[model samples]
Target: MKKTGLTIAAALAGALLGSPALAQKTVLTVGMQSTDAGVLDPHLNSGTPGKAMLQWMFNGLVRIKPGELSPEFMEPDLAESWTSSTDSKEWTFKLRQGVQCHHGYGEFTSEDAVYSLARAASKETSAFSSDYAAFDKVEAPDKYTVKITLKQAIPSLLGIVMNYHGGNMVCKKAAEELGKEGFAKKPVGTGPFMFQEYVPQQYAKLVANPNYFRGKPKLTEILYRFIPSDSSRDLAFQSGEIDMMLGRQEQAWVDRMNALPGVKVVAMGPAEMSMLHLNMSQPPLDNLKVRQAIAYAVDRNAIWQFRGKNISRPAVSVVPSGYLGTDEKAPLYPFDLAKSKALLAEAGFPNGVTIKAINTTLPSMLSFTEATQALLKRAGITLEIQPVEHATFHQQIRQDLSQVVHFQAARFPIADVYLSQFFHSRAIVKTPTAVTNFSHCKVADAEIDAARSETDKAKQLALWKTAQEKIIKEVCAIPVNEMMQLWAYKDSLDLGYDLKASLNLGPPVLETTRFTK
Candidate 1:
């Protein structure tokens, strides 16, 4: 089953369709905690798993680097050379040669880039939507050259391009000729794999892409099995039912996985930050004094005590440690019950404010939520806990717009991705129509705009710092602690866990992977 890196497509082709002596292609069954049961539309789907699946089945002009988190993907697949203006507001890309689209979609062209980006930017196509409201235009100068104009200079432009939702490239002719339904039904891409079938809630079946610019994949078929429960996924992994597991909630479970004779757990550093966010749209959270008090009240050490030593680290800023602009000097809101009570009284809630804290049914999150409840109780705040399914909770966060919720925000390689996703008004979580400001805070839109436009690294950092101060002072979202991501696989499998959300689960790394049989 071993295939050389340079000759992967040849090896797979020989194994799958060419060699008579070779057996059928090996199918890797990947187990995950959640399912892509709702929407296959890449733009509309909020889950990371869905984004990962789409990534394998499509190709973008630019991609994320395999193991790095700097927002630039080396070895351009579609676009060979990309240059950005000194100010970083404008960018242009030169497309590669001999790149053919799968499913009879035709060759790679600047039109495809324009069509794809425009589609993602369009409000009509929900699947291609993004927080890139600042994107002014995407134009095709020639068949192989594409130019992009942004409203502001953002250092994270490359990071945003490599974003899971934004990175997928679409066929211009197929997209226009077939429309949304046509494109969705039989999507085409110039990737290593081709979409064979999608059985909602079961699996997304894919075969090797023959017209893939690079070549065919080593594996004949990839079966992304959507296993809903952690217990089921763990049991399946233990029983040798699946080849790989995507993500695990608790370190103990991941440790247990490593102890198993056939499985090994892969731990990625600073994967996520789990926190209890207060809704600034509400009356109690609207008061900066009360928000500061809540930030001061929580004992992150005690909360992480449930997870044990080395499992989690206390977070001082909304952005985690690994990302840029995380200063050690940033004030850490140490636990102070006295301050919490005083601030609550100052906010006119002397008795305490009753609030609902919503969370998903993930086991580790349950423990984290309970710990938050206990901590808030010490501050004389009454918390009503509500647990929902992960998929449902993701949907609820988008729809109901609650006051308080148990949230786990992931850490990206770049600060811009982190800042833009949560802070920017253009992000998907915020309602596009409403000017209410989704974090429900009193942040100056003009400040966010300035941060988005500032290209100078130091100046951008300063702008982000200002915004962070405003967010913290207003108590937009409380930073809890940073957590790790764990994945278990057979030792025969050589899988690298990528720190950047855009890169880890994408095609470039997957293409380089070689599994021993």
Candidate 2:
């Protein structure tokens, strides 16, 4: 009997050694580009770093197909199936059974879905409340069915419900028990990973969910570390301390990282547009000619050169290029220093104008603002930059403290989402229903509103074009350039799919992600 048992144990040990899964690394360490996570609440957390961590721990009713970015590739996630009314104002979703929420919050059902959507629609609870302004109500008629009624038709209901922004679902029981402040630190969701721990200014750790509806994640754990310095993150990757990292968006950095042995650098699309919002409510900038002069002083090509051409492109309109309804023919102020000087002088600033601006200390943003500062200086405009922590910068700008705000963002790839949030009068900063209108711009409000509910595709596009023309003519903001997402990872990491683009602003680590060796 003893001899037989010994032989069985030896065979089992041999099998384990020969198995590919046993040889693969189970822990994935990633280096992000922020000092820390701002919040974990799916509806309120808007920062890219926070979104990257949240993507692993949450799921929407539906999700954009893995390895795809467009809404056309969306597939059912928590919801098994869904249907919409003929007018596209009412959507009904049938939830999948046995979907478990993290931290033993119990199964996710229609109740959780209804509660999540209502919370997301509340201005007091959600930063993206304006996105759901058209939402009338959400109801759960059964344990596994949810219905959403909207006040007006949007460009796409799927775009709002997919796993981005306010669409990510939260655990109903967990949220009620933890409350708002508590939930922000320890969010509960139905994704493949469960929140394990978060150390401020350091890292947020997650462990795989064994009961994930799809399947168990091959990665047993994920460590999302915050290394704000480029050199530090690069060194960590080289030393194998991190499996992946957010790469710096510059040609030199990309070339250097690609040259490293066993390292692969990737540049993905769905670029984020960087625009300079000259506050129309603030003096100096409030003057129309002054704003146009600032626009003329900005050289989009020079900005494109600063960031590599491969990862950056000149933005032709208020709406980003490649997005729906982008009008490439929208007028642009040429890079004419003499015109800029003449305009500045005409605005009664012969000795150069001084403008105060608050800037984020994030490396990429600081670099861009510094470039803009140099450009404006040549046109006899002195841009006084007050650099602050990323979070503080966002707060101060929203409080209407900055004369000029250099904001970069990517929203749903539609004209209405971009125009309504940035150029509409209702979204003006410091207001009760503020979204992100830092410029206090209302030039295109009429056109933007008309395009939102327009059924005719041709008329919708025409309205959007008119909106872009009006916004550009008013010089509310200077559309600088679009920057694509970039990252560096180990060649051995499979990532589970081909990653062309991601709306989460980072690589999505799914159940199949595993190291080859």
Candidate 3:
């Protein structure tokens, strides 16, 4: 049993629709498609984007500065600055004032922070509780002070705080007021917006929080419509039915939108890594030489060219370019079919190998995988692609049964968590561990442990570099490319995000405000 905090409390019921009170607010309609329905409980949601929405509906004690890169230790969202001991085992945070919860829970106190952190660490809670796995206990030293005791000296403790779903602060009174059942359906938190209602596979609505810590949001309300298909998404944009579309659509349609009287596109490509995950536990890939051969076979440049000029960048390592201090000079596994062939022969697969690749059906993503299929074929490898919907594709990865899978990993400021989650064998043991290392490469255990133990800042970076080298040397997976996400909306609509940091459109709907014409 994974001990994730408030997982049950976060379990959401079907969306509340069309109540007269819900209809009274101004609704700003947006578009989305169907996804694996997520529980509203903050800890239960999966990624950063989910955390972004939760940031609005519920606030944590500490939060990152809007539009800033990772240098964790949450600044005040509900709480002010925190001080940790030099040994890094103990931490004390002071709470902020005048904060109010959606259900009329009064000013926040040290007790709420203690309750929230303690709940997250409770083994009886849920799968997300392990996010607080390092914390031994959380205590309220005073009305405004929270003291936390840790299991070890982890340098990125604050980064852990900002770890999307881990730290959403809930009002204890609100839970008691609504009771378990009602609280699950209508949870309360301290944020800039409050959840209004959700119409499954249709739409979700939110109204501005009058008691928002900053000022109330300019947009009276936000309406998120679940319009899944790209064609339908394009149509919604064309007919003036939506203000923004999340993922990529037909390039022709995007061009049309740009040519339209009032539309613009913002293309952002961060150093985020998207790659093919090869399960080393499976045959064919069970041999390291075979994995290395696959890495050498693919022409990443050709993949980008397939979609036309500069849409995506070919990645040589698991660590994508542009993260803080990531040395680009680090060796890249370049495309060399000859070397790939040689490696395959050394592995005793001179005739090449036939393997199945689980790929997503998303149009933009399909292009890269198709190019992969073509390039691998030339290296004498036969890639039989298994095309499935994105949701199902992810579910399959979770099963750890696929020999090879094509997927995208969106992570942030620190490389540590990114390395730990994907490369660490203990993290992925597939038996209810703290994190899911989907690759199932149990062979990388020593390197993973070394990286985790390193706390000295400079030495940690060096250790991480060594770990990357080792993983590459052994051929963990063929890292493909970093996606360049593009977004287009009415020229007059200021989405209010710094393009450099706005990598994906999944969870964070931070500064989205509809302009008043």
Candidate 4:
């Protein structure tokens, strides 16, 4: 027998209009490891909860297809259509009609779009300020059209920039009325869900928007719970305390969950890169030879096996695989101890070297830190790993506190976004304009700039590859592995999409997500 694509609405119709199998779903509670939502201001909320919340609470001018990570899958979102000038410096977007702002903020228009971009480009508020350094100005033509003029052309604007959180629309009147503190506590946007309550380090609750333009959300309510401990979260999932649990990076954990009755675990692909971040401004690590030694010391393959061969693959480039221009054959450290020790000796550390770095509670970071610590020890390098609270760890890392940083993140679904945010000199940490440049190692800045400016896709990709090759060649930091994201949920749950891969690891429980009959 063939199984039909059973939509929630169809299932409900069959129940009342035909026959009943199980009750319809209206709410779902998901357990995650993030401690808090941080700042819920769309520009500042770079954390997992904040990112997921932003998607639910706001709509971008342009958006990637739901549950799709590829750049080719982008579609019209807030802006129904848009056009660019010949030079690609100026872009005009025609705003969609009747898109009301969440909670009577007034109908969304070009004004909100301009305001949000202006705010995002503000140094005081936005982490993405550096990414938009090329912006000249934004204008609202009449009330339904927005014109963004960039000082320099950015080739990746359409595929990435417009769809990101920084570009997501926010009602000008509502945001200004609430102010920074008020806005963080309660945000208003034009999405299917509306903010209900935020409990800080515990849970953030959101209710379905009745007046949503795309029709009301299927789930009446969605609650996000913060559970930092891996074991505790797994236990909660087993006990059915949480409807969904974020899976650990380890294979054994996922296998155990899969073995459980009435439980299903999904390993989502092209997750993100887990990199061995080296602070170029810091001591022995400041030496390129030392950085190369560190890279050659660790075994990316073995470390990946610790998680599972099926769930992860060795990172070949800083941008990682799956994104366009990410070469599968990109160069990497071959895990040679003798060569690493030789490089260390050449870098003025003959016998051994000790490096201090902090680790987060997140399984990805902790696992990388611990696994690499042993490998480095074997190569006569001692790595002191200090575990820090996730929030504190983020603050300290940006302040240039650690010599090495083992971080995992899916920055964006494009090559430019990842390269610019992580490698660009303007994005250096602790400076007035700071983003996520953990290593503070400048590699091919001019090349990256040229790539962004290049209108031709082939040339842009070539320049991006050139920049990444320079990074790998300079041994700025070690590219460890790109891990898989696993989510454990009840068997009855039926997410509308095929769950192939997600741009972000969050389960796509949109208006279509429900339970099967």
Best by lDDT: 2
Instruction: Provide the clash count, candidate 3.
Output: 11
lDDT of 3 by residue, 125-144 (tens): 43345456567888898888
Give candidate 1's whole-model lDDT.
Answer: 0.67
Best-first order by TM-score:
2, 4, 1, 3
* Model 1 steric clash total: 4
**TM-score, cand. 2 vs. native:** 0.95
- What candidate 3 gets wrong by more than 4 Å, as runs, is 1-26, 33-37, 47-52, 70-74, 105-107, 119-131, 172-187, 249-256, 269-271, 307-311, 325-327, 442-448, 451-455, 495-499, 503-514
TM-score of each: 0.86, 0.95, 0.83, 0.92
The window of 10 residues in a row where model 2 has the poorest summed lDDT is 17-26
Q: Against the hidden true structure, what lDDT does model 2 obtain? A: 0.90
TM-score head-to-head 1 vs 3, winner: 1
What candidate 1 gets wrong by more than 4 Å, as runs, is 1-25, 72-75, 126-130, 181-187, 308-311, 425-430, 433-437, 495-509, 512-514
Tens digit of per-residue lDDT, candidate 4, span 333-387: 7989999999999989998999998888676668778988998999989999999
What candidate 2 gets wrong by more than 4 Å, as runs, is 1-23
Candidate models: Cα lDDT each: 0.67, 0.90, 0.65, 0.80
Q: What is the Cα-based TM-score of model 3?
A: 0.83
Better of 2 and 4 by lDDT: 2
